[model samples]
Target: MDTLRYELVFSEGTDSGSSAGDVVTVERTSATGPGGHPVYTDPTGIIRAEISDQGEVRVLATGGHQDPAQGVRARPLPDAEERS
Candidate 1:
C-alpha cells in the first residue's frame, strides 16, 4: 500500500455564484502509473472539497490508497484570465 499526499491552491473568483468557503464535489478513478503499475484499486467516488478564505482549495483523502499518477485532477478553478 502506498500513501499519496497533495494540496491544491486557488487564486480567487473560482466559484461563480458560491462564496469562497464553499464545499465542492470531487472524484477519482483507477489508472496506471508512469511505470505501468496499478494506482487506484477502486472506482471513482465523490469527495467534498473546501475553499479557504484566502482562496485556497484543500482535499483530504482517508484510507491508505495509492493515487493515480495520470488521471483527472480535482481542484478549485483558478481566477479567470483577464480579458484584454
Candidate 2:
C-alpha cells in the first residue's frame, strides 16, 4: 500500500555505472512467513537494516516480490565510491 521511493540525485560519476542520485526504488512485497502472518507471529521479527558494507553510505535493503531482483540484496554505493 505504501509506495516508498528514495528521491535519487546524481551528483558526479563516470560513464561506467550508476551515477549519484539514481532515484532507486524500495519495493515491498507479500512475504509468506511467520513474520508477516498475523496469526503465526506478532509481525515484528521482520529484519531491517542491521549489518552492511563498510564503505556504503546509504544502502538500499530492498527485496520481496515487488522487485525483479528478488532475494538478491543490493547496496548501491555513491557514484564516487563505485569508481574505486
Q: Which candidate is the best by lDDT?
A: 1
Worst 10 residues of 2 by lDDT: 37-46
What's the lDDT of the predicted structure labeled candidate 1?
Answer: 0.33
Per-residue error (Å), model 1, residue 75: 9.6
Error of 2 at 37 (Å): 19
Show the colliding residue pairs in model 1. Answer: none
Candidate 1's residue-wise lDDT over 1-84, tens digit each? 222221332224454744344333332235433443323222234332333333333333444694412222334333224222
Best by TM-score: 1
* Candidate 2 residue-wise lDDT at 70: 23
Residue 52 of model 2 has an lDDT of 23
C-alpha lDDT (0 to 100) for residue 58 of candidate 2: 30
* TM-score for candidate 2, residues paired by index: 0.18
Q: After the best TM-score superposition of candidate 2, give how far the Cα of residue 67 lies from its true spot, in angstroms.
A: 21
